[model samples]
Target: MPPNLALEIKCRESERQALLSFKQSLVYRYDILSSWTTQAKANDDCCNWIGVGCSNNITGGDYHITRLDLHNTGLMGEIGSSLTQLSHLTYLDLSSNEFDQIFLEDVASLINLNYLNLSYNMLRGPIPQSLGQLSNLEYLNLQFNFLEGEVSEVHFSKLKNLKALDLSDNFLRNCTLGPYFPRWLRTQNFSVLDIAGNMISDKIPRWFWNNLSPNLLFLDVSYNFIKGKIPNLSLKFKTMPVIILGVNEFEGTIPPFLFGAQNLDLSGNKFSDISSLCEVNYSSPLYLLDICGNQIFGHLPRCWNRMLNLASLSLAYNYFSGKIPHSLSNLTRLKSLNLRKNHFSGEFPSWFNFTDLIVLDVVDNNFSGNLPSWIGLRLPNLVRLLLKSNNFHGNLPLSLCNLRRIEVLDISQNYNISGTIPTCIYKFDALTKTLNASEVPDYLKDLVMMWKGKETLIHGRNLQLQRSIDLSCNRLTGEIPNKITELVGLVVLNLSRNELTGQIPYNIGQLQSLDFLDPSRNNLCGENQDRLIVQDLLFAISSGFIIGFWGIFGSLLLFKRWRLAYFKFLRNIIEKPL
Candidate 1:
């Protein structure tokens, strides 16, 4: 932006007043609007204001504020009508705010707008038909909103100059834009297009595959009912694009040409064999490939050694059988691997070459034999280790204590594992810490899990359980480990159905992060059960408080009896004897 020296003489008074009216219709969490004042003392300059950019007009009109970017600012409320008054605006972004829907209905009046983003807001209702009037728009993003209903050609009638369009995470479903694929999409060339999670159900037309933009670098149409096989478009994309078509009804084998992309997710489809994995030439640049929850089966592919850049691979929830091939161990940079819910059997190969693993999930399979003792040493950075419902047997490995960064460890329901719980369990350092939902690590969001007794596949983000250990449903004998209470970050602790005898740890209440706990069906019985239950109930309440004082524990808030009883429990723990 060029320097704005003369603010008063250059800025048009009417446009500056329009900006003030724009600020009037909203709520502000900070005094960020102080510079937008109309007071004479502050110079009443709109062009020099924060987030406001002005440019000299070719016709020599007053310097007009051509840009207004207030993304992620703490502004909330409905879109003001005064925005349309700034007719010279060519760039505007009001994303990631607690904002409105009416803006779309009037934003089209700014015909000069070449870039616009209102994503991650509280906008609702049908997308306004007037948006089609932005003929010069090159970028438009309305992702993460509540807009819905059929999207017709009227929505994009004059948007021929559009280069990037993202309408992800809404309830929209239609075509003309959803009984069929958008017929008009083939006309406009897009560098980035994301229409994921809209209920558009139709086969991707062949013309779309033929006329795919050569400049396309990102295309996501996942989480819908769209079908038809994805064709190989390696030659179409001049630069490798990140393509995601997951959770759709697409059928047929994945094309080997897709391996040419930088990142690809064809998971949750009917794609048959990954024989294409072997067809790709060595030195493949693919870094992430998730084909999980498909019907692809047969022995594990042995060509993983070819893709040296492959770091994250997820093939869970498929019919894959046979031992994991040794070639998979060749990728030294492998970080995350998910192979759960398959027929993979045999003791986990003790010779893994990839030490960069942060997430190693192989749950609910038929793999047998003892848990590998070398895992803790081989993958020191392992954060999540899930191996539940497998046929693995034998005592818990003491070497697991060396995993200081382990946050999630589920070695449950493998009945044959026996012996006392390790006393060095406190050595798993990450469990001893605490974190709220918003503070959760980015990579952990890749998981889909539910809390409480039922473990279902739901996108984890809200009230989802994290951290903790699950060593339940085993033949392990001996007393409950008292040192386990040191793990203040443990969220779900299920030690039920084990032969463990003795009293519950008195300091178990120290686990303030416990969301779900089950010591029932074990030999942990005594008059202390009431005391322990009450103590854990308080922990559950605190856990609920950590993730916003609502959800999952609402019964205590809504019912008077439960509310009084909770207060009584609190009074008892304070005044009465145990």
Candidate 2:
């Protein structure tokens, strides 16, 4: 072998040994890198490790570690400093681990690192300023950590190659970035920037709209103490696809240009006047919009019908009044619609174009008129149907029983809805077993379950345990059908304040999973009354026998004359009373 080649091989072996130190620091129950053993008989090449990647350096003609991805490995323990020894590493991802107290300065030696993700860990302490030396970094994510202290501009001043930066869900209250929008962000050309769920209290600076990089595609600064009116952008964000500014204190009208964003979440803000939202460009392709919990008033703009790509729309808890625009049916891709706690009046539109809707919540509205049965026929995929606290009248639609995937059905508080509860409620498949639609988002599938008479919102975990039926406070008069017992998985049943009469179903005890039942103020009677009367008669007979026996025995023992007189009186009455 050539002298240079022999030395290169020796260096590779030594660097391979350095990797073992990092492996020892982590506790992997599944042993994701079980191949990383030290036995001579085992595969000694570090390149063969489960999450390690290697490539040959053309100049050095030796293999070097270039990537180390151990995300979601169930690994725990502090990220040991030995990882810095891999000087040739360009990609390092230790996300979704239990690593704690990870000091960024320890990994500063890896100057070649172009991608670093330490997100979703228990990392604490301040970010090390030495990270700024990694000029080659293109992606850096330190989100969802316990990190504290300031993160000044100097920490990222030299990262000219950075295209994406995420430091959300961290304790950056003392960070020098903001009490206002970070001015330093203007110097960087970030395509993706997320500083949400932090303690950044600041007004969105005026320059933010004018100076946004044309290359920017995604921006999020939600869940902060940001306050002020959003200024209109002169330069149209033609290429930007997402902008999330929800859960903030931003007031005033929404910028007209913002309607062009494909994915927007401006919920939980104090913004008012949605007149500009009605003027979105015809060609705009908005998909997801969550402007709920805002003070925005006025009717929905007619332009909403043009958003053909719209999927989810949440306008709940707003002051918007007037009938739902007929144009909404034009959004054929609509999957979820929430207009709860609004003043939308008039009869609900009978026809709808969005047949694939999964969630529809229109609770606490002034909607009067028969709930169009088309809701069940048109939206067959309904998972959560919340229509409570409305003026909807007439008999409950029997077609609603066809919604097999429904997990929650709340139609209570509509006094005019007078009819017997549907017997086909047991056919709802989602209530029969725990739903396993993990493929969909959590917001799309959820139900308000009643456990021990307390209502609780449930989603994802333990959600399948919720099966409720609320038809109380109405004028409905009829006996609860015995078929209701078929819904053995029912967790809550409320038929109170209704005129329902007749004996309670004999099979009521079959609902073993039932946690709550409210039949009060109704004419319903219990079928167990006969059994209870028999029990009372048996108790009375037993008490009488015990008293008679004790009295006769005591008198015979203490008063001989009284006992004889009592016996004689009983014999005379038995012989002559008839």
Candidate 3:
């Protein structure tokens, strides 16, 4: 067709009316589809409207709408059936909406759809099997939705051109995907497959791997109950894949076939050994390796120097013991290291000088001795330092105050740790100012923290502006440092269950952002005692009251300072001004 002739073509009036009817059914946050109006002459052309794509299939025939992209437009309500009238549509995107599930059946009538995305919506109930009628659909995304019921092979019986499928974060069942090996997928070659966070609870059949698409570049089956060990076979890949099989029940030695992946996560499984890590031939440069919460035990492999490209590594919640291999220092690009809740013993690695390091979590380990004083000097970029529940015994190193960007500092529950709270603690500027969301690293985005004796997972957006310090359940004995109150952005400050004495900081009230402050069980008392919540007050005095209230009060009366404070409190209660 001539260029001038194409410009002269106008969309069929029927399709324009259909789109206008569709808009009547929508409840949008803003008038994003304001161009869909039909009052003006140019606006009457549906093909010229925003997000609508049109093309002339005939030399002189009328143009037809072939695409409708409305994802993330904040449109919600009952999706109108008028969309079924646009039979020429080869591409359609209606994701991230809150529309009702009344149009899926109507959508099946359009056999020309080659790309369909209805993810992150309120579409509920079983997917209509008639959807398979669209044999040209090459990509389908139904993730993060409320769709339910068992999906059989018939649901995709005619989708022979399908190349990518995502049904993650749904309420689908194990049987929804069918037998040990979905033989229905033997013919199609997919590049990306994600079925995570579902009810998948069967061992991956060996035959399934043989049929796996060689073109696959991304696979995520995490957060399921898949069982059995991966057969020891040297599988190959055409691309550097990013595979995630975390939070499953796969046990035994780490398989070598997985080494070909550039980013791999096998955490929260029953795997007992990882010697294969050192034994395998390097197939690709690994960037991220997370095997946390597994049964892998004994000394870490000393061959970490082989993967110098490693940036993020996590072996937390495992049984691994013995000193961390010194070869870890060879990974100069390391940015995050999480060895939390393990039996790994020895002093914290003082030699690691990775300037790009952002997060270091070694909580609940047997690591003992004074924390290496060179931490701040070695890793100046440290943002979250969680060293709680260890045998670390010594004064809180003042050098730690040099971590200027630190947001969360939890050196709590180390029984033998004793010292006056460092006055230089306020140097952590991240704790005093509202940190921009961009300043938080990707590794600390899902960082966890203990708040008020309960474990809480604080996400990055909230954590960026929230600062915390937990030094509870330790033997620290001294007056709480007055400089601590300078951190105006501090949200959670816990110093409970310690033997600290003297008054609380006089400027404690200055922490305007303080939400959960616990100073219970400490001998410290002051006019700012009202800062502690009622629950903490009960926790502080209930134990002594149960043990022997009179005895405890009698002992306090023997001290002149305690006696005067007690009488003053009693007099204030009795001499009511009213």
Candidate 4:
């Protein structure tokens, strides 16, 4: 071989060795990628490799790896410093993997990384301040992990090109706004930002809204302890924004201008009157509006129809009253409507129509009259129907059985309705659990009995019983249903405070899952002394039986003549009912 030919061969081999070194570094840095064997790397194909993207060079020499994504691969080792060798890498995603505390320092070396996601991992310690070096980064997601640190303004003020930032679900504590929560962030082209589920408390800095650029499209600060009134910001952005400020301690009325947002969620706040919202025109392309779990009062805003593009509306746990607006049906795209735990009084609106409706929760309201048969027929896609604690009269709608996909159906507190529950309810494949209908009307007494039953006396594990039924505190009369034993999943039975008579069914013992039993305050007579003794013994063993002795002695004394003596003593003080 000539010297020139030998030199050319040596140069080619040097380039090949460099490429091999880079590939080996990637495998060593991430534990999951280490599985790629030396044989697999020998293949002359770069495009077919897993989790790597390669683009052909304009000179047609070789393909260069442009992207590397190894998300959720259970990689349980410290990120090695060798990753910095991937100089051509533009994208790196090591999200949802376990890493040690100091890995962030090594990650900071990836200066060219534009898209970096390290979310949902067990990485701990303060976010390395060196992250500020990534000036080219556009998208950064570090959510749902145990990353703890004080996210100061200095830490985030440097990422000028960042468009999306998610740091939710972290142990970040005592975070105070540093000269306005990275106010420089507004100057950049950020569209989506999520900083929820942190210990961030303090009045929402005014600079957040004042400096917010119209280019901002999505903002989420939910599940933080933020307090103070929501800021009223002037709209300057051409596109409507989606804002979520739920699960905070925010007080005062919601800013009416917020209605202009496309997706606004102010739920779980201390707001009182949202009537100011009626003044705002909802002509914007709003999609979701959630103000649930607040002190919001006043009637349903008739202007709701203005938001024709609305898809989900939740105003539950408020003091709203009067009829639900039939105008709501105008939201043809509506899929979810939750107005539970309000004072709204009126019959179910006949005009409520939406073929795409999936969730309808109007529970615990003052709504009266019969259950609309057409509700089930109209909302065939309904998944959750909660109409409990209302004044609804009439029998249970048999048409409700038609909802094959319904997962949760709660309509327990309407006293005006008479007759048995539709047995077809048991046939729904999606019905995984059902609350006892009898417990709602007389909830206080039934709750006490339920509490007593949970006392450790039953000594059984995973006992299956009949459906809990509480028909107490009503006009219900007649012997206790013997068929109750057929409901093998029942856990509680309360027939107290009614005109129920006749001996207690002996088959009641057949309900092995019957943890709670309350038949007091009724006309039911007769006593199974042996059964009562066993129940007392079980209760004693489970709960240390502090009161069982007193109960048994009191019952025996009453049976003897204590009641007659008490009556005589009362007769001496007052005139007898002769």
Candidate 5:
């Protein structure tokens, strides 16, 4: 080999030794880099190490390290300064690690980096402003970190080529005087941007939305303290595909243009009305819409049939009244629907054919009339049905047993509803067996239920694959069905405050997974009552015998002549009762 080629090989070996030193400083539980241990034997090259890659130098130069991906490798250590040795690195990922107190100054030296991810780490302290020096960066993710302090313009001003940026779930707060919108982002072009779960408290500036880059497609600012109303959006620019402004303090009517977004989330606010959204000409590819936990009132408008792409719709915890618009049946793609905690009255709307419905919650409403038996026939995929605290009356339709996938069923607090619970309740297959972990969906319906005598808020994975049956606070009469004991996977059972007669099922103990059980304030009696009577009788007999024997014995001991007469009387009583 040429003398210059030999010198290049020696230099590359030195850089590899530096990287091995950096790994030694970490606390790795798994042997993800078993090849890293072969360096001492000179049998392995640095480029062949796990999570390491080398670049092909076509210019007759030595190959340099270009990529280092150690994501979810169970590494626990400080991001040591030794990483600066890999000057030619273009991609670096150390996400889902336990690296604390990172030295961003060391990372800033990698000027050729194009993508960097440090998410899901124990990083603390301020994001170094030296990161702005990486002009070639295209993607940067720092989510799920303990990073604190402000993020000034100096941290990203030079990164004009950045396409995606996420800084969510951090303790970083904006120290601005007015609006939380960062002024530095006005000039940069970004396709995806997320700053959720931060301490940003201010009104969104009017210019922020109007001046958004035409390439902008997704924006998330949820879970902040942002206040004030959103200005009328201009349609002159390209329409955004996704926008999330949920869990904020913004109050006022929702903008009509928001309905045009494919995925829009405006839940947990004080918006009063959304009728304008229906009045507008919505022609975008709408998918998911969430406006729950608001004070929205008025009947749902009838102009929603055109959006055929809708899947999940949530308008719960609002004041919407009157019947549901029948035109909603046209959207055949609907999957999940929530209208709970409203003032909607009159008979339940049985017009819509929800063939793909999975969750239906209409709790805490003034809905009256008998529950239609067509629920199972119309919605075969139903899993959770919550209709409690309503005025519905009449016997539970036996056809409800046709819902084989039902997991949660609550129809309690209907004062006029009467009759025995159906014996075919065990047919609910979802509640018959213990739900496997894989059967639980990632996102389930959210409902506020009276569980275990307390109001419980359940949703998402917490409510997934859980079985419960609530039929309390009603005027129903008849025996508690013995078939209910067959539901070995039942999680909660409530039958309190009812006029039902007959004993609780003898096999109630068969529900091994039953965590909560309430059968109080009912006219039911069973072995429990018999046990109480037997205990009382035994106590009475023992007390009377103890008192009478002690009274006679004390008298005999006090008087000598009486003692002799008592013995004679006992002998005479044994012979004859008089």
Candidate 6:
């Protein structure tokens, strides 16, 4: 045998071994890889697909699979141990799929792996300790899964190079760090850390914030059972873009440092006093500040002029009182302003101008006087206007018709206006559906019926872009307009609590797109028990004819009484004839 022939044979054998190893690495546990056949593999150009990566150069011209990403592909089945054959694999992403009981013991074999993502899946069971063997791993994301078990220091302390970690939206229980924070986590300079929506219960350790890297910018620990006073930061970083600690059982006054931060969201908590926020230097560029659903009390900070770049301001469901500052008009860039369910009192701010405002929700406030007519005209971009349960007066602003982009307008319970609804109000082409007015005149009722016959009402059917109107409590009187049926895109119609007296047009039932309909507490009387019914027969009888019928019946009864008296008189006269 020649030496060259023997060498060729050896080379062929090595190639065969490489191919077999590559095929084995593709298989997983629970027969999951059975559906991923060779034909399907060929469709992806021999595994050089979008979600797969290889390191052929490092493995001496052999295909060394490194990365496997199968996110959002509707994949199902348990992970297989065959995946361990890819010793050089580094990155693996299987998020937003249906993988259940994801075995992790086999993952420890991939010693050279770096990034791993398994979020938004049905994976369950305790995390494997073998995961710590990945010494060079950097990022690990396992959010939005059903994995349960106590998260111990042993599970995380081994990953020394982890820079970005997200274990949010899980059922992990009892995540208490005894006295001090994990020393291994403190060593790594993580920039993004999210452990939100978990069952972790314990006082937020001080060392957790103290040891955070100066470069940390985003930190989310929300939706947990963690309680205790919020730690005060050293203010070392120049910019902390996002800090979300909402939906927790945290109690105590919010630290003053929160007001100075750029994006502070401490909503859904038990903070009692936020007046300290008013003292924060507003020189910083704070874009979003949401502190809704808290026990905070005190007047809104009048220093709103300093937050020039503020975009969203939500302080709803609080005990805040005092006149809404007219200075809020200075927040010209404001897009959303929600101060609903608060104890705010005083006249509606005349200078309140939100040119860029998309959502202006001030419902359930102690506001008085006519709604600002300029609200619709000035804020053309307004999408939702909820001013219910207030002391607003005057007729519906005709200028509100200028809100061509308005989708929702709920102003029920403000019972101080009296007048026929203007016919021109229906001209808002952008109007999808409106609330029943409290004081509908006869003419407006007729107009509504007329509009219902138009064919152009079927334009906007999508719920996202549809418009709806609600006018449940008013002094409107007249037959319900059939034209209301013309609003083919109407999703909700609430005309309850009005003095409207008339028959509800049968055509109203024709509104196929109507999802909600309420006409309660109205004078409407009709055959439809759910609708108001008007007495057409009573209206048809003329006044002269009704008077004639009463006169005839009275004459008949009088004649009978006279006959009895005459008979008695005759009897007395005959007896005295002598």
* lDDT (10s digit) by residue, model 6, range 1-578: 86553223111223234334444643343443343334322333334444556555655665556777777776676677656666767888888877785778887777888888888887888777777777788888887665666666777777888888887655443332323334556656677788665445667777666766756677877765677887666554456557788887677778766655568788888888765555566464778888888888878767677778788888888889989876677888998888888988877777877888877778788988877777777888776677877888777777877766665666776776544444454555555444522121121111101011121221111222235566656655555665555654454455666666676656665433322234455766554543322222232244226434543454333332233234335445755757
Please estimate how well model 2 matches the true structure, expressed as its whole-model Cα lDDT. Answer: 0.74
- What TM-score goes with each of the models? 0.81, 0.81, 0.82, 0.69, 0.82, 0.72
Model 2 C-alpha lDDT per residue in residues 1-578, reported as the tens digit of each score: 66554323223666677778888777777958787777433245667678888888889777888899999998888776887789999999999888886657878879999999999898888899899899999999997776767777778888988889988666443453566666667667777899775556988777667767666689888767899998877456667469898889989988877777878889999989777766665656678988889998778887676578878998898988898888887888888999988998889886664678877888888989987877778888887778888999998788888888876677888888988787887787766654444323654554454443466655434343445677767888778887777665554567767888887787665443322234465776775645544544564476447645654565444442343345435545755845
- Please write out the lDDT profile of model 4 over residues 214-323, one tens digit for every residue: 77788887766788887666664566898888888899977777777888988898888776656665475778888889987778777776788888888888889999
Superposing all C-alpha atoms, what RMSD in Å does each candidate have to the true structure?
8.8, 18.7, 12.6, 14.5, 18.5, 21.6
C-alpha positional error of residue 306 in candidate 1 after TM-score superposition, expressed in Å: 3.4
Candidate 2 Cα misplacement greater than 4 A, ranges: 1-14, 24-27, 34-49, 55-63, 101-103, 171-178, 211-217, 234-240, 434-440, 446-456, 510-520, 527-578
Candidate 1: C-alpha RMSD after superposition:
8.8
Model 2 clashes, total count: 0
Instruction: Provide the global lDDT of candidate 3 against the true structure.
Output: 0.76
Q: Candidate 1 lDDT, tens digit per residue, 1-578?
A: 44654334566778888888988898989988888887643255677778898888788655888999999988899886899889999999999898865567688889999999998898888888889989999999987666766687778868999999988655342221465678778768888998775557999987877767766789988766898886765553468889998889988878777787788898889988888778776578788889898998898889988788988888989999999899987788888889989999898886774678888888888999887878788888887888888998888888888888887788888988998888899897877767633233453344543245568442234324567577877888888778888887776677777887877677675554332234565666433556656776776576557644443255443433244345435544665656
State the lDDT at 476 in candidate 5: 71
lDDT on C-alpha atoms for all candidate structures: 0.76, 0.74, 0.76, 0.62, 0.75, 0.63
- Model 3 lDDT per residue over 266-317, tens place: 9889999888878666634678899998998899998887778888899988
Better of 2 and 5 by lDDT: 5
How many backbone clashes are present in model 1? 3
How good is model 2 by TM-score? 0.81
Q: Which 10-residue span in candidate 2 carries the lowest summed lDDT? A: 510-519
Q: Indicate whether candidate 1 or candidate 5 has the larger lDDT.
A: 1
When 4 and 5 are scored with TM-score, the better candidate is 5
